[model samples]
Target: MRSSNLLKRAHSHNKQTLSSLLHSRGTSPHPQPDTISGHKLIEEETNPNYKPEHWYPARIGEVLNHRYELLVKLGYGMTATVWLAKNIHADGQSGNRKYVTIKINVNTLGEDFQKGRRAIAEKLFSANPQHPGYAHVRFMLDTFRATTKYGDHLCIVYDVLREPIDLCMKKFPGSRFSCGKLRVLLPALLKGLDYMHSECHVVHTDLKPDNIMMGLGDPNLLDHFVQHEHDHPSPRKAPDSHGRIIYTSCSDFGESPTEAVIASAKITDIGLAAWGDEKNTKPIQSNVFMAPEVILQAGWSYPADIWNLGVMLWDLVENIGLFDSISTEPDHYRPEQHLGLMIALLGPPPKEFLARCAKAKWYFDADGQFKYPKYVAEDCKFEHSIHRMNAEEKDLFIDMAKKMLTWVPEERWTAKQLLEHPFLTKERECYWDTPSLSRASTASVGSLIPSRQGTPGLGPTSVPNGSIHHSSLPVRLLELVPSLASSDATEPRLQRQSTNGSLKASENDEKSTSSSTLPLKPKMETLAESKGESNDETLHKKRSVSVNKSNESSQAMIDAILNRGKNHAPKAPAK
Candidate 1:
């Protein structure tokens, strides 16, 4: 007993020493008043190496101010391209690789809808604003690069995140994360969402596993050898001669004293999210986890965010999305399954809510008339997949999940309510703290894949952005052909590059490419003038001229925006 007590005291003393080490660096793992004050002193600096390329930035060869070499393409969505890059700035002095992931969104020829969303992202980014509750989502590096696919797409240089959370968990399947870590990440995510909803008044509209990133454990995704700063810090290693280490760093751009306070995952991809899209009044992206109120065109609010948060929480706790309905038609996605999920867990929607759904044709109408179907199938049983769940577990998921994913947007759990839920409070385990979390399998999602047919509404008619002209997600793309190598998929795209940075489309690309890859109709005016079908589209648009040179929303863009306003002037808030 005496020896055991000595051991306990030794552990305590060592922990205190580690705390002092971190504190001496002026970096605290947790936000204490004194540490928080220190953060205010870190100022943004101009990295001499930063530069923008005018060419269609693809592959690792595109020029980034002629310093950082784009290495490997990490991932790409319809509109964004993620790449693993190496800092040429090192001049090979350290012989060590310092890597960062660059998220590039090309600005091809101007399309009103496309440009509008880009405009919002640009405006928010240029302001370079930070919310106290969020982890600092700094524009670590930025540059403008033109691409033929869209005309010059704005390329944003950011510190790349390491890997998918699922991939991380798989590596340590038997490991369990501690409650202290969950305390760190969940509050950060909530802060990001909260910032978007209240401060920016925009909804992410898309939140899923792939979008969330991890700092250490899964694989050194950002560890391209050179030192890089990421939101999540990497474990400390013995210092090298240069006094720098690779892989991880930290930031608290958004967090305040409140752990659950929402932060800035700023409503990105404005091509799909409009400022006044109160009712989801227009077309947008498709997928599971998107809230029903959003799909039904039934006037969504911050609650749509709650639905997404619920989906995230459930998956973290049980490793399964509550409803993961994929389809082959209209781009193989569905959100209507949310109703079935709702019904199974909370029982049928109240008649009044059903009435609201019935009147909304584009979202829930049957007969394949509108985009998504309204009603649930008869056998829907909202059973969660938590292995041997007891009654209390059922209450945890069914009650909270249902509350967050409720039919009436207003009825869903507010961010505050989600914080109060038993599931979040139950054990304090975080996805990160799980020791065996990294060893889990990616294929073993708790929920089985749903049928390809569910709700309606097609994905964007044109490729969204950064979506390879003919490519699906990289996961789906790689899966389509078992034998093709990841590098092989990119080789073909690189072969067509012009000596001067243009990608001369091959005869096959011209024919097979979706219409979105083609150049826009000749603009009678400059990019800003020709931005929107009318001004209404501008809600999602963010137009920027080379600010180092001029200031004013372009005439053509302004005219197009005004024109769109006539078609759908946003509905004013209800009394």
Candidate 2:
């Protein structure tokens, strides 16, 4: 079967299974309740660290900036609550209603942090908007402040997007992306990273699955979502002691996305991003994906993001972290263990590299031997870990991984260089274009624009003007990589030799290929449609909803909650 057909079948099976489950439970697939008893814990209220006062008390129907109207809760995090909102005052010339995502920050953040965030946002906005990778980035669109009795809240806006990539991965079989999907995803991801590193001079310190979100390919989907919410308001918890009503977050975007929608995935959550020039030892990145330099307190720059992405690929493909042994307790991070795993897989770091690390002495002795040598797991070899790919595919993937996972940050491939890897381009051709299966090509155009009532995942058929050709990439960008060229000529100093007395093909390997022919372009519609803040903070895990309650009983519970709220005399809406 063709890959596209397989994807469609998978989506169909998932939808059918969901419908069956909902039917078995005697409830609608999209259930909306007016209210639930405040006694019932939901979402953020269940968070052990949740503080009511720290959060902005945003109501479902409340209007912000006299323009955007909050429709429903989308998600929440440590720092803010995200809402799907409708723009009441869109550009009159277009006469089209626009939907946007609003991230309302908590009031508890310090003034200095707030100012720094604003400064970073400004720097992101100043990046070359014309860059091909610009569309692949979830850039901030607008910002304003909302005032309340508790404190002032910062409101940042962005284009309405679907669920994060991490959630999307669950829909796929084996909880991993198909090679076809990876081909579409990785190139776009790398392009966005390149734009951040080279054109914007920004380093996205956080590059995990949660930070990458699937873009809504059709604007009509947003319209449908808004109409759905208007017709059926989401169920909300009754007024709490402070009159706070928490609504069940509705993050689903109706149906499963087509390959094109998946292809349009964008890198998001620049909240932890920093300027590349401002290299500092301040610890950043999620603990598992933390680069060696970061763990060692060695100053890092854009190359750190390459290592982060390299580790993240395992999560995307293997459905588990590559460095699972880094922490003995699931909640606690062990730097020594992580370094040990790195050494076991990639061999010992060079003495020169360790010399720059402030914390190297804590783990390594005077001669550079790991003090805790027992921590190194001999079986933790990269070749032995990957089980899914064929030999050819595995070879290409390992080569790409090695390029990005080096101990010396400078030895890691730039995002642009990785874009040309055979794992993405050549493997895509072999998988998608096999002669045995005949169908319309499923290859992505590497760019997308919103279309009205289009086929699933299909974007505009023609490239827009000002589309970027690979050949047109500036020479200076290529010239800036003298270290990579020099490093490629010699064997990598850090690679471990296998017991067979031969080094793995992943180490110090290079393949010469024709220049990338992929046509790159900005999403023209995104420039206008995109708006919103990054909800990059850690979010509370979603609790499963029970479907056992009958509609009549549910209505009765809502009515009782309403009567209870009335007796207490809930506070009036804010002005």
By TM-score, the best candidate is: 2
lDDT of 1 by residue, 1-575 (tens): 00100001111111122223344433445522212222121111011221223224353355575766765444444444555667767544433235555656534435685566565556445432655433433233555564453356656566544444433343333322223334345545665554554455555555554455544222332342222222112232232333311111222111121222212222222334455233354433344555665565555545565677676665665544556443424444444555555555555444445455534544434442323334454444445344434443444445455555555554443443343344443332211222221122211111111111100111111222212222332443223222111233334322222222323331122222111110111222344456635432431231111000101222232233334444445778999
List residue ranges in candidate 2 displaced over 4 A: 1-41, 91-97, 328-331, 427-575
Q: Which stretches of candidate 1 lie over 4 Å from their true place?
A: 1-62, 87-99, 106-115, 122-132, 136-140, 147-151, 174-184, 216-271, 276-279, 325-338, 355-384, 388-394, 425-575
Task: Give candidate 1's whole-model lDDT.
Answer: 0.39
| lDDT of every predicted structure (CA atoms) | 0.39, 0.63
Residue clash pairs of candidate 2 = 157-531, 157-532, 157-533, 158-531, 158-532, 159-531
lDDT of 2 by residue, 418-490 (tens): 7645466442323321221111111111111011111111111221232222233333322321111213424
Q: Which candidate wins on lDDT?
A: 2
